[model samples]
Target: MSFVGKKYKLDKSENFDEYMKELGVGLVTRKMGNSLSPTVEVTLEGDTYTLTTTSTFKTSAISFKLGVEFDEETLDGRNVKSIITLDGNKLTQEQKGDKPTTIVREFTDNELITTLTIGNVKCVRVYKAV
Candidate 1:
């Protein structure tokens, strides 16, 4: 098994806060982000892999292989499902039936960068091991 794990302390930056708010996340989630200590784990087994996120507010698991489509509800419970494709070390995901929502992920310098896009709005969250 090839895996990388990191615990990140999150500060609800203005951009992220605004984005989540716009997505209709409740006040609790917004408050949770302020005091969130999230752990992210990535495991790679051949072309199939799993990514997990755990925190006080939410826990989510995603499993996919390269160039596969998976239906996933957004954190806000929106019906934005995506198909993920790996391009080298970066991941590109586009909503299957919705063109307005997209996500991209990249790992570098022991940090994980994830960008979420909804329509014309884009929000980025950065995490590093504690």
Candidate 2:
């Protein structure tokens, strides 16, 4: 996969803290989340794809097969049933749990652009390849 082993650094974000509040994330957690500029990497081995996110606060990773549902513990501590699908250069994830959320990651040659939506709130985060 072209994206495998490629790294992306968070360059900017919009309305992320508001989106976190919609998810019922606590104040402290939301503040930390807002301050974090994480690095993300995706890797593949055989049939499994692993996406890892790293920040000064913590590191989180999830592994799954495309189109298959898996249990996920989100960065903000939500336990979710998640599935990821791909179309062209966009990877879309749907998470069902206490609240349903949709995350879409669109990869371009120089950036990974992510949009998060939940409860009418949408947050966009741009990560430049480095």
> Which candidate number would show the highest TM-score if scored against the true structure?
2
Candidate 2's displacement at residue 59, Å, is 0.3
lDDT tens digits, residues 1-130, model 1?
2124444434233367766766677888877765675777777767777777788778987878777777877656666556787776677878754345677877665666778787667888777745
Leading candidate by lDDT:
2
- TM-score of model 1 (CA atoms): 0.78
**Model 1 lDDT on a 0 to 1 scale:** 0.68
**How high is the CA lDDT of each candidate model?**
0.68, 0.93
Model 2 spans > 4 angstroms off: none
Model 1 CA deviation exceeding 4 Å by range: 1-14, 96-99
> On a 0 to 100 scale, what is the lDDT of residue 112 in model 2?
97
- Clashes by residue pair, model 2: none
lDDT of 2: 0.93
Native-to-model Cα distance after best TM-score fit, residue 30 in candidate 1, in Å: 2.4
